[model samples]
Target: MKIQIRLVLILFNSCLCLYGQENPRLDSLLNVLKTQKDDTLKVLTLEELFLEEFYTDPTKAKKYIEEGLELSKKLNFPNGEGFANYYLGAGYYQTIGKNDSARYYINEALDIFKRIKHEEYIIKMTNALGVVEYTSGNYQKAIEYYNIGINYSRKNRHWDNLANRIGNKSLAYIKKGDYNLGVKYSIESLKLFDSLNSKSNTLQLKIHTATAAVRVGYAEMGLKNYEKALEYFERALGIYDGIDDIVHMGHTYSDIGNVNLELGNYDSAIENYMKALDIAKKKKIPIMRGHVLINLGKTYIKKGDYEKALYILKEGLPFNEQFGTKDNLSLNFNQLGNAYLKNNDENQALVYYNKSIALADSINAAEILSDVSLNRAELYYDIRQYRNAYLDQKRYQFLNDSIFNSKKSQQIEELRTIYDTEKKEQQIALQEKEITVLEQQAEISALQKILLGIGLLLSLIGIYAIRQKMKRNMLEKEKVDAELEFKKKELTTHALNLARKNETLENLKSKAQELKDKENMGRGYNQLIRTINFDLQDDNNWENFSRYFEEVHKDFNSNVKTKYPQVTSNELRLLALLKMNLSSKAIANILNISPEGIKKARYRLRKKLDLSTEDSLQDLVLSL
Candidate 1:
C-alpha cells in the first residue's frame, strides 16, 4: 500500500488522500469523524480510519467498516461501499479464520467495483482475494490471482503494481516450497522496482524495492542460505526504518530473527524477535506479533532453555492459530513437541507431535511432514514401539524423496521461466529506449518552423525514394548476374558432353582409316569415315552450347565483333570459351585440339584482339 501510494503520488502528480497509506492519528480521525457531515467525505474518512485500525485492532476496525458500509449504501456510493467491505473482509480473514465470511464480503465488494467499472479497485480486491487464499494455504489459487494482476498491470504499464504482483507471486512459491523459483521471481520483482527507482528517486519505489528484497530474503532462508538471507533482511529493515510502515517493519524484523535463528545466533535471534515483538505489540499488529512470538519461542528452544520454550510456545499458540496459516501453526506444534521432548515429558511430546503430523498431512506440507515423521519415528523407537517407529521411518523417507523430486521439477520449470522473463525484460528496456528517442525526435520536429519542417520532410521523402530506387536497381543487376552464372554452368556441361561424343567419333574415324590402310578401300568403309567426320563436326552440338553461351553473356558477341571487325566466327567461339573461365585441357577437348594447340590459339586470338603482354586473356574476355 505504501509502495502504491508513493508511485501514484509521484508519477501521476497526485494521489487519492483517502486511499493513501498514511492514516491520521486516532484522536485526529475521531475529531474529523465527529465534525464531518454524512456525505462522501465522511464515508471516505471512515474507510481511512478502518484501514488505520485494521491490522492493529480488528474490533475497532470493524466499527469503522460497519459505519462506512451503512452510510455508503444509504448514499448509493459504490466506491465507498467497496472500500468498507474490502477492509471488513481483510479483518475477518486475517484476524480470525472466518473463510466463508471473508470470501462473501470481499466478493461483494468485487461485484460492486465491477458494476461501477472501477478497474483499480477491482485489481486491489482481486489481490486481496489472493491474499485470502494464500492465508488459507491455497498456494496455487493465490498464484493464479497474482498472475491475473501481473497481466493487467503489465498491459497498463503500471510498473509499481506489476512489481507488487510479481513479489506476491514469489511468496506463493516460497509457501509451496519452490524456493529456487521464489528467489528467481523475487529477484525479477526487485529488478523492476530498481528500474522504476532509477527513473525517479521516489520513496514509494524504494519501499517496493525493499519489500522485494525482503521476499528475496525469505526465499533464500527457505533455501537455507542464512547469511545471504540476513543481508537482504537487514537491507529491507533499513528502508522500512526510514518509513512509517509499522506492518512491514515488524515483518522485516521477524525475517531477520529467522535468519539469526538459522545461523545458531540465539542471542541475536532473540534480540531481533524482541524488537519485532515490541513493534507488533506497540502497533497492535496481531499477525506480526504472532509470527515474532512463535520465532522467539523457537529461538529459546534452540538455546536449550526448554522451560522458557514451553512457556513462550504456549503463550503464542492462541495468537498463531488466530492469525497465522495452518502450516505455521503445524510448525509451532512440532517445535512445542520438541520442547516437551527436551523437558522429558514423553506423553505431552507425543501428543504435540501427533497434532503437528495431522495438520501437516492436511496441508500437504511434505517438508514439514518429513520433519515431523522423523521426529515421531525417534520418539516411537525411544518408547520401544518397534513397528510404529519403522512405519514412521518409512513415511519420512517417502516424503523426503517426494519433496526432493518435486524440487527437481520446479527447478527445471524455473530455469525456463527465468530465461523467458529475462528475454522479455531486455525487450522492454529496448522498447523504452526507443520510445525515449522517438519522443525526443517528436520534440525536435515540433520546435522546427512549419515551412522549414515541410521542406525537410519533403527532402527526406525525396532522399528515401532515390535510395529505394537504387536498391531496386542493384537487386535487378544481381538477379541478372545470378542467371548468367547458371547459364554459364549449363553451357559448360553441354560443351563437355559434345567433347566426349566428338572423342568417340574421332576414335571410330581412326579405326575406319586403319582398316582402309590395312586393306583395300571399300565404298561403305569410306562412307563410314565420312559419317564419322560429319558426326564429329555436328553443328547440332554447337547449337545448344551457342544458345546457352549467348544467354549467359548477351552483349559478348556484339561487343567483341564491334571492337574487332577482323574477328572470325571460330575466334569468337574461342573467346566465348575463354570468358567461361574453362581450363586449357577442357578447352582443348571441346575444340578438338591438344592442350598446346589450344594455348597457342588463345595466344593468337589475344594478339588478334590487340591485347598487351600484361593483359590476362580470361580477364579481358570475362569483362566483355
Candidate 2:
C-alpha cells in the first residue's frame, strides 16, 4: 500500500496526564468549581476543568462546558464565556469529530472573542476554525486559516503559537498530497521550535517539540521516506516516554507501527499496535483507542486475517461513533466496509460503504470518499449491479482526480524547477572559482620559469604564493559579505510578502459579519481588543474584495494599505479608526489601551518613521 493511516492531534497541542488513580488536576478543578466563593473565578475554573477532561472523559467535558457557559452568562463574564465557547467547540471537533457542531461553537466563540477584543483568543479561535476545516478534509482551506495564524504569530512574536500553526499547515500540505512542501515546512517548523526551546527549555516546550516532530514524521511518511519517518517518530516517542505522556506515546507508537506496516513487516506492526493498545486501555482515551483499534484491524486485513479484521473493526466502531470526528467516523465506516467485503459479507459491506460515503460527502472528505467509492464499486460489480457499479467507478475516478490532480502535480514540478535552477547556479559559481584557481596556478608556474635563473627563485615564488593566497582570501570574504547582504534582503522581502498574503486572506475570511454593533465594538480588535463587553466588530480582506464577496460595510479601509505599504494590519486598523474621527476613549478601549498608551503608540509610530515633533502622526497614518 502506498498510503498509511496517521494519528492526528488537535490544532493546538494540549497534554493529558493519566494517573493510575484519580487525576489531581481534574480533582482540584472539580473542588474549585464546587467550593469557590468567587462567581467569576468559578466560571473560569469550570472551563479549566473541561480542558482537563476533554480528551479522556468527553461526557464530563461537555457537562463542564454547559455549566461554565450558563454561569458565565449569569455573571456577565465575557472572558469566562469566551473560553467556555472555545472549549465547547474544541470538544465537538477534537473529542467527537463532528464538524457541524464544531463549526457552530467555534464560530460562536470567535465572535465572542472579537466582541470582547481578546486578541489572543481571537487568533486561537481562528486557528481552531482552521482545525475544524482540516478534520473535515478541507485541507487547502485549512492551510489558509493556518497561514493567518502563522503570520499573526510571527508579527506579534508569538513563537510558540507560530510553531503550532506551522506544524498544522505542514499537515494540511501532506493531506493535500503536497509532500515536498509538507517536508519543507515541517523541517522549518521543527528547527524554529528547537531554537526557541534552547532558550526556554521548559517541559511545555519539550512537549511542543515532540508534537512537532510527529508532524515532521508524517510529512516524511507522505514522501515515502519510511526510514526518516521512523526516525522522527522514534524521537517523538522518546520525548513522550520521558515525560510519561501515555496519550501522545500511544500516537507515536501507532505512527511507528504504520511504517512497519508499509514495509510489509506485519509482525512488527502487530507488536507496535499491541504496545499502543496497552497504553490506550490503561489511559482510556476513547478517541485514541478507537484509532489504534481501527489501525490494528487494517493490519489484520493486510495479513489476510479477514475474521480478525471483522472482529477488530466491529469492536472499534462504537468508540469511534462516541468520540471520533466526522473524518474518524468516515474512516471507521470505510474500514468496517472493507473488512466485511474481504470476509465475503457483501450485503453488510455495501451498507457500511454507503454510510461511509454519506459522511465523507457531508464533510467534503475527498480522500476517504475516493477510497470508499472504489470499494463499493467493486462490490456492486460483483453483485451484477453493472449500472450502479459504473456510476460509482466514475465517482471514484472524479474524486481521486480532484485530490491527486494535475494542478498539484504542476505545482510540485514548479518547485522542483526552482530548486534545480538554484543548484545549477551554485554549480556554475563553483566552476568559476575552479577556473580562477587554475589561472592563479598558471601564473605561479610562469613566474617560477622567469625566476629559474636566480638563487632567489624559491623565496620569490613563496612570496608570490602567499600574496595570491591573501588576495583569494580577501575576494572570498567580499563575496561572502555580498551574499550575506543579498540573503538578508531576500529574507526580509519574503517575510513581508508572506505577511501581506496572510493578512489579505484573513481579510477575505472576515468580510461577512453577523454582528451589527460595528461602531460599539470598534475596528481595533485586529490591533488588540481586551474588555468584558464583546459586541463583535468585523475589522477585516482587500485585493480579493472584487471576487463577489464584500465587507459588511462599503468603506475604502482596504485602500489605506495601498497608499501606505509600510503599515501593518495592526497599525492600519489604528490609522483607519483615527481617519474615521473616532473618540480617543473609544479608540483606547478598542485597542485595549489607556489614553496615555495611545499617546505612547502614536509617539512610537512617529519614531518608527523618523518623524520630528512637528510632523503629525495622524496625518501620516491618514495618508495611508
Candidate 3:
C-alpha cells in the first residue's frame, strides 16, 4: 500500500512539472512572435498573446488588430476578418468624423457577434456600435446601445467597464439635450468609479458632469465643479505626460478654458486656450485647434478687444473651412461680427451677423437662432431703429417662449418616455399599432404645429447659410487672386535665375556624356533626375522618400559623412543629379544649380575626387 501511494505521488508531481513547462512554452512562443515577420504568423501570435495578456498591452492590442486585418483577407478567415473589421471600425469611429463603411462593418460585426454567441465580443461590438451612432448624431440609437452595454457589463460584474458604459450613455443623453438625465448617469458613474478607486475615471465623470451643468444653466455650480474637474485632469495630465495623448489633453484644456470663460476669468481662459491651441497645432489636429481659436476669439470679444478678436476669428476660419467644421466656423463668424460691431464697422458687422444667423439655421441650432435674434434686437436698439428693434425683440421672445414653456417641455418628455418604452418592447413589428395611436387628433395637431415652425426656420436658415458661405468664398478667391499675382512675379524671377544656371549645366553635361564610354548609362541619370523632381514636388512623396531612405540606410548620417569625405552636402546633391545623367539645365532647374557651376563641379569631381578612368563619375556615385 505504501509503495502504491509513493508511485501515485511521483506521478502527480511529474504532471505538475509538465504543466509548468507548458506555460513557459506558451510564454516563449509569444516572445518569438514579437519578432515574427509574416503577417499571418504575427496576427495569430497576437491573438494568442491577447488571450494571455491583453490587459497589459493596449498598443500591442492595436497592433494585433491591424495585423489581423491584413492577414484575414489573405487567409480568407471570415471570423477573423469580421472581428478585425469591427475593432478597426471601433478605433476610427471614436474620433470626430463619421465613416459610413465603418458603421456598416460594425453592423455586420454585431450580426456575427450574435451568430457566434460570443458574450465578450458581443459586449465590445455593442459598445463600439453605440459610439458610431453617437458620432453620426443618432443619439437615441447610441443611448440604446450604451444601455445594452451597461447591462451586459453589470451582468458580467465588470464594474470598471460598467462605469465607462454608463458615462458613454450620459454623453448620449447630453447630446440629445436631456442634461438632467445625463447628470444623473454621470454622477452614478462617479460613484462607481469612486468605489473602484479609479481616479482617472472619477475625473472624467466630473468633467462630464460639469459640462452638462454649464449647458443646463447651472453656470456657477458648473464653474465650481470644473475647478475640481481641472484638478483631476491635471493629475491625469501628469500621468499622461510625455505620452502621445495630445488630442485628449488638448480637449481637457479646452474644456477647462471654456468653463473659466463662463466664470468671467478671461486671463485664465486665455492661458488654457493657448495651451490647447499649441498642443492641437503640434498634433496637427485642426478641428480641435479651430475650436480653441473660436473660443479665444469669443473671449477677446468679451474683453472688448475688437482687433484681437477679429485676428483670432480670422485665424480659426481657414481651419474650420478646411476641416468642414461649420459649427466652429459659424461661432467664429458670429464673434467676428460682434467684434466688428463694437469697432463701429456696421456694414461688416451686419454681414458677419447675417452669415452667423444663416449658418446656425443650417445646423438646426434653435439655441443659436435665439441668441442671434437677441443680438439683432440689441443692435437695432443701439442704432435707434425702434420699429425694427421691437420686431426683432418680439421674435426672440416668441422663440424663447416656445422653447421654454412648461407645456412643450412636458410634451417632449412624454414623447421621450413613449419612444423608450416602445424600443424596450421591440415594438417595430407593431408599427401599425403605434402609428395608428399617434394619428389621434390631439397629438397630430400638436406635432403639426411644432413641425411647421421647425421646418420654416430650418429651410430659411439652410438657404441663407449656404448663400453666405458661397459669397464669402467668392470674395476670398478674388483676394487670393490678387495675392497670387504679386507672388507670381517674385516666383518667376526665382525660376529664371535657376533656369539660366541649368542651361549652362545641361551644355556641360551633354559634352561629358559624349566623352563617356558607357552607352546604357544615360537612362539611369534621367530616372534619378525624374525621381528627385517628383520627390520635391509632392510633400507626401517627399516624406515617404525620406522615411524609405532612412529605413534602407539606418546609419545614413555616419554613412554619408564617411563616403563623401570631399563632398559638401550640396555638392553630393549635385553629384546625385550628375549620376542621374540630367542635363545641367534640369539639375539647375531642380537644385537651383548654375550651368557654369555644374561644369566647375564636374571638373572638380574628376580631379579633386579619386575616380578610376574605367569608372564613370555617374556610375561611381550611383554605387554609393
Candidate 4:
C-alpha cells in the first residue's frame, strides 16, 4: 500500500516537473510511434510526447494532441479521445492562459472519466477545474472545487490526494483574504503529510508542506501577527533549505522580509529582501526579483532613504513592466510616487500617482488602489487642491473599507458552517432514503405541479417582453438609417464645394501667369504676379485638400496604395481626384497642368495597377 501511494505521489508531481526535464526515452517513444501499426499505442505515445513538451513548447504539444485526437476519433476510442482533450486543455491553461478553452476541453475529459467510473482521473479533472477558476480570480469557486476533491479523497482514503487538495484550498483562502481558514487548512495539510512514510514521497510532501507554511505565514502577515508570521516563515525556510529548494527558499525569505517591514525592522527587512533578490537573480526568476525589489524599495522609504528607494525602484520598473501583472505594476508605480513625493519632486510624484491609479483601476486591484489613492490624496492636500484631495480621500476610504471589511471573515466562516451542515445532512439523508422514499416522492410530485404552473406563467410574460424589445429595435434601426443617409448627402456636397474652390484658384493662377509673361507689365508687377501663381501651386494647398479628402473617403488612398505599391505619390493624388468623380478637364485645372498631362498620369497609374486596357481607370478609382 505504501509503495502504491508513493507511486501515485510521484506521478502527480512528475506531471508538473516533466516539462523542465529532457526525457532520454523520448527518442525511443518516437521510434515506436513511427513504426507501430497499432493506433492505440500510437495515441498513447502522442499523449506522452504532448505531456512532456507542453510547458517548453506548447505549439509542438498542440500538434501532437491534434493528431492524437484525429486518430482517436477514427479508431472510436473514447479513452484516447478523453486523454487528448485533457492534455490539449492543460497546454492552453499553462501556456496561453486561455481559461475558457481550458475549461471546455477539461469538462469534456471529466464527462468521459465519469462515464467510465474512473475515480482517479475524475479527481484530477476536478482539480484542474479548480486551477482554471483560480487562474481566472474566482477564489471562492476554486475553494469549492478543491473541497469537493478533498471530500472525495477522504472518503476513499487517498491521503496524498487529500494533502494536495488541502494545500491548494489553503492557497485559495489566502488569496481571498480569509487568513484564519488559510492557516487552518495549511496546518491540516501538514498533519496529513506527517503520516506519509515513503522516502521520495516524503521529500515531495515536505516541499508541499513548506509551501503551505509559507501561505500560512502570508496569511498571518495580512492579519498583522508579525511574530507568528515570522515563526511560520522561518519554519518553511528551514524545510526548503533541508530539501535544497532554492526557489521556495527565496520566496520564504521575501515573505519574512514583508513581516519585518510591517513590524518596523527596516534593517532586517532589507537584509532578507536582498537575500531573496540574490536568489531570484541567480535563478533567473524575473517575477520574484521584481517583487523583492519593490519590497526592498518600500523598506528604504520607511527608513527615509528616498535616494536609495528611487534608485532601487527605477531598476525594478522594467521587470514589473515585463512581468505584466497589473497588481505588482501598480504597486511599483505607487512606490515610485512615494519616493518622488518624499524627495519633494511634486510633478514627478503626481505623474507616478496617476499612472499607479490607472493601472490599479484597470485590474480593479483594491489593495494597491487604496494605498495609491491615500498617497494621491496627501499629495493633493499638499498642493492646496482641496477639492481633488477630498475626492481622492473619499476613494481611498471606500477602497480601504472594502479591503479590510470584518464582514468578509464572518461571511467566509458562515459559508464553511453551511457547507459542513449540508454535507452532514447529505450523509444522513443517504442512509435513511429507503425508509422515506414514498413520502418524499409524494411531496416532490406536488412541488413539481406548482413549479410547472409558475414556469408557464413566466414563459408567457417572457414572450411579451421579447416582442416589445423587437419592436423598439426596429424603430431604432429606422432612425439610424435616416441619419446615415443625411450624412452621406452632406459629405458629397462638401466634396463638390472643395473641388469648385480649387478650380477657381487654378483659373486665377493661370491669369496671373499669363500677366507675368507679357512684355507690357513692369518687372515689379510681373514678380508680384509670379508670387501669386507660386502661392496657388504651393504644396500646403494640396496638403489641406488631402486632409479634407481623407475625411470624406478615408480608404480611397490606402486601398489604392496597398494594391499598387509601386505607384508614386503623384499617382496616388491623381487617383484621389478621379475618385471624387471629377472629369479630366476639372482635374487638370485643380492640378494647374494640361489635360494631356492628367491623361498621361492616369495611363501610368493604370499600368502600375496592372489594369487591362478594357478596364476604365476612372471606374476603378471611383469604386476604390
Sort by lDDT, top down from the best: 1, 4, 2, 3
Quantify all predictions' global Cα lDDT against the true fold: 0.75, 0.70, 0.59, 0.71
List RMSD in Å for every model shown.
27.1, 26.2, 31.2, 24.7
Write candidate 2's Cα lDDT for 431-504 as tens digits: 66556655656666676645542434465457656766785566567545644543443333333332333332
> Per-residue lDDT tens digits of candidate 3, residues 27-100?
68667886887656666665555333322333565566667767877876667766766754654333324458
Q: Rank the candidates by TM-score, best first.
A: 1, 2, 4, 3
Instruction: Give candidate 4's error at residue 83 in angstroms.
Output: 5.8
Query: lDDT by residue for model 4 over 1-624, one digit each (tens)?
Result: 001111112223422433223344667778877897758888988888876655335677799888999999899888998888877775545435577998999899899889889988888888878877776778889889888898899899988778878877766776666666667777777677766734345666777666556656766765678899799889978987987877667767887887888888999999999999998888676767787888899899999999999999999999889753667778889999999999999899999999999998997877778888989988986785544664686587567657634444444463455456445755565446433544444566677756754674476458646755775566457545544543444444444544554554454445545555674655754654465466556777578568767766768788877877788888787887777777787677667678899878877777778889899877777777
Model 3 off-target regions past 4 Å? 1-38, 41-70, 78-80, 91-96, 198-246, 380-391, 406-624
User: Candidate 3 at residue 391, lDDT?
Assistant: 57
TM for candidate 4 is 0.57
Which pairs clash in the backbone of model 4? none
- The residue ranges of model 2 lying beyond 4 angstroms of the native Cα positions read 1-8, 14-23, 74-76, 93-118, 326-330, 337-624
| Candidate 2 lDDT score at position 476 | 60
TM-score of each: 0.62, 0.59, 0.51, 0.57
Which pairs of residues have clashing backbones in candidate 2? 96-324, 97-325, 97-326, 115-534, 115-536, 116-534, 117-529, 507-541, 508-541
